[model samples]
Target: SAIYLWRFGSIKSRILTVCQHFFFISFRARPLVQTFTSWKAPIIWEEMFDSILYDQGHTDKNSSVALTVFAVGRYLDAYLKTFLTSAEQHFMLGLPVTYYVFTDSPEKVPNITLASRRNINIVQVEKHTRWQDISMMRMRTISETIESEIRHKFHYVFCFDVDQEFKGRFGSEALGDSVALLHAHYYKLPKAQFTYDRNPKSKAFMETGDFYYHAAIFGGLWQNVKHLVDACYLGIIEDKLNNVEALWHDESHLNKYFWIHKPSKLLSPEYCWDQSIWDKRDILITRLVWAPKHYETLRSG
Candidate 1:
């Protein structure tokens, strides 16, 4: 009887110990694992990023900024004017800005009176018949020009579509080694639903991705931007060689590059809002991107 009681007590104690270990894993360890894997949490949290990150007073005084845009034909000229004027009014107000306007006819670039310490540098390039070609061409053009003109002149550069107008402060919160904007349409969507290039033959193909980054606005440190451009340009060349083009052209290439090399900072959909497509209550529109115009009519001479 004594032996039976002792053995039973030992078994009970071991069972209790096992229960405690299981409880710790179920209650404590599981949450830690989930926290690490949560996709909603940005790699660079919003609280840690702000204008002060790039403020000259806090860091270097000689830091300069360049804004790059391709306003290829007459149709985009009107939008470019609004983009430039609004940028002058709200973009890095105190910092030195050089607008590198890539256009077929540089003379058509609006003669806007830029703010203090701001200037425009028009870069002429041959025009392509298709808008898609022009978009892809921008990657090669920017990569080439940055080597010659922009790299020596600026510390940081921002590549923006000519269709957006700054409604609020597009300040230093955006500055980083490599910055990418979450697509306004797909930021809340699941990874499976993201419109990444799915064709295995294409260089931009990705079976899974973290975010559907918008190609409309992307830039960072000069070296980082240059690296991104070079990669996209090469990806396009490889896709062409294979007789396959990514579904979204340069945008797909940009997404693939950013997926393999995560951006240092990711801007919320607020950075690229289309008022016509999204509800105001759902998104805070920091910049208003005009709705897509009919290319046939808009691009006509």
Candidate 2:
């Protein structure tokens, strides 16, 4: 009887020991795991940034050539700052760049320059059409403004929407001499998007075809844009003949021409990613820069 009792007690004690061991292990790891996680973020961010800088060749001439923006009333402050910041970081390094602002309200923009060099040129565009006419008249206005004011003098002209902030180098190293296009979230959708997707070479996903780059925002060489604007003019006229209004105005026409002709290369999505494009975690390590004030420096000194 005593032997039996002793054996039962031994078994019970052994079970308790195992439970205690597990509890102790988990307890000891809790703070360590937290520390490791905390330390991991900076390392990841540094590595990702290094990769981007390396890929961009870290040179001024190799960086983006120029920046062109289209803005309206009461929004020029933020847009100009974003443009100036980008020019400071990338173009001012060595690339001869210009920030051409086409707006009726150019005088309202703050005069921010990179390294005391005059970096801004504000072109006053007549606001003949209301904001509601964004689809047709606004597009023509922008095109005509570029034709008249820009004269296609810039090597690269980014017709950025006033609201966006540029995150990556908009230079030759990032995209080479070829045209660079930003892949929009709606790229896959037909009615909602304008770019092509069907691959001429692939047999898989034939129903959807191979995706072709259709459009870009915040980046593109001026040479391609001149051609694209010409094509868009022709396409828009054709659309009028058929009475089909484009989904996103001239942007759609630009996508269609680029898709058919494949005149541009696809830029890394990280370059112009908005909040909707990636989650917080993905954005945390990215050197993603933008305006409109949603994100700030996460780490404080």
Candidate 3:
């Protein structure tokens, strides 16, 4: 009888210990599951951004879109021909388009015969010795140009790097009141891992953020684009005043603006991809960005 009682007590104690351990694990896992469920990935889904089904023909007739690029020196001119030709072929095929080419040597711009509705306006800008200066200067030039020229001429504007080539259709489906592209490298990482300007002294600094947007591609309504450029230019000026430059120059400021302002539409990495470095299984190539030349050689005249 004594042996039976002892065995029964041991069994009961073991059962109670198992129950406590199971309950503790369940309790711990509950919050983790909630956190994952509540967290929203910044990626915009295909159904939301698909341009094929959108009535682009109707929108094209009514919209005037401007594409802006800054190719300041000789090295980038090699890329200009392909960039211009592809854009003519695939970008908003029937829309009234203007290519605002900001460059030091306007004559170097290819004399490609654009479609009747498409045209290139070469705006001469003073050449800068450093590519970094050119990158930062782009915002000031874009803001001033929009105030003086682009605002009255176009309904929408897109800014892109001159080094890229368009491999597939980059169409009106990308259009938005405000649009920003996720950086190809950091799109999948947690916000903590995003490469934002971390310096507290810089205006672009962010302790936490939702997306690390690429400055290479961004656009919106004339007003929104203007606001974006103006804000970035001002941020740069503030950094200059503080005697600190943000880590990635203009890109840092861009991420800062969109983090606070949150773009109305977010483009997937498919919009801007470095094909040479990445052969991502999930990414369908809409545009293929070429690897850039050596910074010193590319920027030097």
Question: What C-alpha RMSD separates each model from the true structure?
Answer: 13.8, 19.2, 16.0
Per model, how many backbone clashes are there? 0, 14, 0
Residue 147 in candidate 2, Cα distance off native in Å: 4.9
Q: Model 3 lDDT vs. the true structure?
A: 0.71
Lowest-sum lDDT 10-residue window in model 3 = 1-10
Q: Determine the backbone clash count of candidate 2.
A: 14
Clashing pairs in 1: none
lDDT of 2 at 24: 14
lDDT of each: 0.71, 0.44, 0.71
Model 3 / residue 177 / CA error / Å: 0.6
Tens-place lDDT per residue, model 2, 178-280, is: 3434453543346433333233221111123223333335344555555555666666666666655555556555555644545323443444555665444
Candidate 1 residues 149-172, lDDT tens each? 888888888999887788877776
